[model samples]
Target chain A: MTQRDHQQKKMQIRDGFIAGSPIVMGYLPIALAYGVLAQQSGMSLMELTGMSLLVFAGAAQFMGANMIAFSASAIEIIVATFVLNFRHFVMSLSFVNQLKRIALPWKFSLTLGLTDETFSVSSIYRKQANQAYGQYFYGTLILVAYLSWVFGSLLGGLLGDVIPPQLSQSMGVALYAMFIGLLIPSVKKQHKIILISVTAMIVNYLLQPMIGEGWGIVAGTLVGGVAGIFVLDEEENT
Target chain B: MIWMIIIGMAVVTLIPRIIPAFIVDFVDFPNWVNKWLEAIPYAALGALIFPGIITVVPEQPLIGIVAGIVAIMCAWFRLHIMVVVLSAIATVFVLTL
Candidate 1:
């Protein structure tokens, strides 16, 4: 590559890292908990880390660990996780406009790392910038978030048993905090967001006892999303 | 047997994330689809956070709620995400002390 192109690439990568820092921070404690939980549930270090490496979704990983703890069959675990991660299809399709200029191979590889945290952070960045999402920018964000997850799992696998009970348990709140942070600015910008989100939360809560784990979220997402479309914001309309 | 579970989880998770992006490149989504897509993040994050947040710390559910309120405040003020996260963690730590 030419000198200027190389310099641009470096800058984009740096931006990606900066954009991803909060997500990395957020992922660290949760992934650590996941690792610890997996280890306590009888997974080896390799199995724990391998799951982190290959199946990077936080919610699904937790579900898998819980099911494994109960000795759920492999097919049952897989099917449950697939249903849990079905929201990724919505996330991916939402990102299509920003991802248009990216090459096919890079786009495909980058999608592999499309966790909830990365999607929210990168979407905010893409909205603010005049340009399309650069390959290096997207790739670096994914790489850093992915590594933090893997390493956090590894640490948990190694140290899960040793950590004080209270401290590790406190880390459970971090992921929810991060998700709250991600949603606040948007909700502020568009008042309609508050309605959609609150409705979804209520629906999820109401459905949880009846429908069980993952499906509640699915039902909530569909109801809230459909409800949101009809409640158009005045700002976007003009 | 463990290997089977790991591979199975990997394939199922990857398919939802990867397949849609590939298809979207080829086909155009209708306007209603676009509108629903826009709301996906808000709806998904909402569904994921609530009720679950209350239960995150089963022993002291109040601490989780307090931390979540702290997070909402920080984000509302447009503080850095790291700051929001750190402060929430600190809230939980302090309450438990």
Candidate 2:
């Protein structure tokens, strides 16, 4: 590659790392909690970290650990995981659609790192910055976030007993805090989002008793998306 | 047996995430479909935050709520995400103490 091309690539990687740093901070506490919970559930350090490495999903892994603790069958846990992660289908579709010009290979590998945090950060970064960042940027962002998760899980699994219980419990709020931070900008841009988001939250809340949290999220997002189609203006930029 | 369950969970999770990338290349979504897709993040964020936030501190749900409100306030000012998160954590720590 030319000198300018190489320099630009370096910049993209640096920018991506910067963009991903907050997600790293957010994931550490949550992943640590996951490790502690998984370890408590009788998962070996290898098994817990293996799940983080392979699965790379926060909510599903937590649920999987919980089910294991309860002695839920393999079939039940797998099915529950599929149902919980079904939201990723929409997220991956949106991500692919956004970076349509990028190569298929990049899209394939990048989607593997697509979690709730990464997807929200990327989408908001795209809309707010109005820049179609390079695949290198996304690649680096995903890499850092993924590493932090795995490392945090390893630490939490090993030190599950060392950390104070109350402190770890308080750390549970970190992810939700990050979510709120991501959501506020969009809500400010479009008042319609407030309605859509509230609708989703209420729907999830009401349905959690019957359909469960996993399905509740899926149903909530679908209903809220449909609400968006009507509530959001056609001329409005998403 | 545990390994089997873990592997099974991995496969099921990977399928949903990876399949959509390949499919998006073949299909061209209509405009309305695109709009719906655009809204997914916000909706999903909403669902992910609620109920989960309230239940974060299982023993004292109020601590979670107070921390959540602190997060919303920090975010409203457009503070950095880390600041928002840290502030919320601090709120929880203080409340629990």
DockQ of 2: 0.78
TM-score for the second chain in candidate 2? Answer: 0.95
lDDT of each: 0.81, 0.86
User: Candidate 1: global Cα-lDDT?
Assistant: 0.81
Q: What pairs collide in candidate 2?
A: none
Candidate 1, residues A147-208: lDDT per residue as tens digits?
99999999989887565767666676777887898889988877778888888899999998
Give the alpha carbon lDDT tens digit for every residue of B1-97 in model 2. Answer: 8888889988888888889889889998888988888788788888888888988878778888899889989988889888998999889888888
Cα lDDT tens digits for candidate 1, B1-97:
8778999999998988888667867887776776776776788788878888887678777878899999999999999888888888888878888
What's model 1's lDDT at A104?
A: 72
Which regions of candidate 1 deviate over 4 angstroms? A1-3, A128-133, A232-238
lDDT of candidate 2 at residue B4, scale 0 to 100:
87
**Alpha carbon lDDT of residue B62, candidate 2?**
84
* CAPRI docking class of candidate 1: medium
